[model samples]
Target: MSFKSLCVAFGLTLSLAACAVGNTVDYRDVVPPLGVSGSKSVAVEAVDQRPYVLAGDNTPQWVGMVRGGFGNPFGVHTVSGAPLSSDLTQSIIDSLKQGGVKAVPATARMATDRTLLVTIKNWKSDSMVTTSIYIDAEAEVRDQAGTVLARNSVQERVVNEGEVAVLPPGKLERAKAVFRRLMDQLLNSSIRDALR
Candidate 1:
């Protein structure tokens, strides 16, 4: 092959290799093992996820190493995935239902005495040598009269190395695990307290 053709072929191979490096997994599969068991009906609104940031150019590159460190060696871009708000809301609703709560998706005309609202303040994963994930958010429970019954700020962390290896290997898997843990903490603490 000529010099120009060789250069183009090399570039194409690198591009393809990069594309194959990142894994895009679904958020729906990251279900936690614990949930509240109750007959109380609850409505969960689509969570507000405006503040959440997935992998980005500014995110440290070491995080990509946890997933085999190939496609995005620099970790300059995140593997594309689902919207956080939709996935998180659905996951919460599913978990509540599994726990025996009559959980339903919130709607404008729906009649429910209790409503749950969540706003994600931060969601991030990092690695110095090993991966760690952190989440911060606010949650509120209110009654039909719009009376706030309980409110709290929630934060959780999972370390992916040594004895604290709570997360899995892929970025999508790590995200799923983080979300599951975060929701578990939210339900067991703030939301449970509010319902009482």
Candidate 2:
């Protein structure tokens, strides 16, 4: 092929590539539904850090969603194959910190002065992309040697703005937000109940 033709083809390819790159979409940056408030009434204490449990294991627990099936298209699922568990855990930890509650570490020095066990039972979103996340969280706080300080279960459902009341496209995000809000509530409630 002639050099002139080769250069022209190369330039056209580069231009097309540039345009494609520029038009790339980023769903991650999509604006989530509003009305997510992380306010709570707990005076988080800077005290002993405790370990948490998930599914009967004394490990770093994750705020998992149950998953919306069939009609629940825009439900809580991974973006590009990344599981939402990690994000959920981080959100919970952040909310706990904001609420002033001391979190138990996953491992190391102390023998877990306290243990917080959590579980997410069911999660779903609707057809019009409206998301509704429901979580059945069980917080079982125990001292060293497995002595239960407090054991409580909390069920919270958070709804977001979308086309239908079913679930939203940002279902996973809504679940995480609601989990944070509910964590604060649960932490405060558990602490208060334990004290009483």
Candidate 3:
């Protein structure tokens, strides 16, 4: 075999190996700190997620994968993992409870006067040597009569410090950080203000 041909084979092997790494998607839960106090009782309604965010099987769709370094400038890869809207809804309810608000599951009756509705506008990640996860959501508060009381939009960006292929766990950690931050902002500020 020629020297150039051998080198080409070796490069192809390496690229395939890197791409194979971190193909499985994992989920992390968000837990908020306790301290802030509020005087509102709210029932968390089902969260609405954009259609393109999920796969046909109902799992979160994998965002496109990105390569590290500058060798293949035009290469795009697929990433695994996404948080379900139900999971996010639960997280928000938990955070609300921690923040001294009476939060309950949404029901047709025997509930609070106010209902919280959340819409996930964007939830995506950009992979590379360093990965950035972006989350954007909007929340609204309404009375039993369907009158909109208050609404707010929250967006968060988090960057992880590692290559996606080398450290797949770091990507999940960064995603958790972004989720936590978004929940914190919503529970402490946005939702609190809306209730007031």
User: Considering every candidate listed, which one attains the maximal lDDT?
Assistant: 3
- TM-score winner: 3
Residue 182 shift from truth in candidate 2, angstroms: 2.6
Residue-wise C-alpha lDDT for candidate 3, range 1-196, written one tens digit per residue: 9999999988965774475355433322463653534776778864546555543423344432444334332222223233455555566567667777787767545568678887876665655567777767787889878888778787877777655355544554565566677766665555566664
Q: Give the C-alpha lDDT of model 2.
A: 0.41
Query: If ranked by TM-score, best first, what sequence of candidates would result?
Result: 3, 1, 2
Q: TM-score per candidate, in order? A: 0.63, 0.45, 0.64
lDDT of 1 by residue, 89-194 (tens): 6777787777777777786557776888877766555543356677777778998889998877767777766523332234446555766767666655656756
Clashes in predicted model 3: 2
Q: Rate the local accuracy (lDDT) of all candidates.
A: 0.59, 0.41, 0.59
Q: What are the runs in model 2 whose C-alpha is more than 4 Å off?
A: 1-75, 78-88, 92-104, 107-110, 127-129, 157-176, 192-196
Candidate 2 local lDDT, 42-130, one digit each (tens)? 22121212222324432222223322322222112334333233434444444544445554333334444455444444323222235
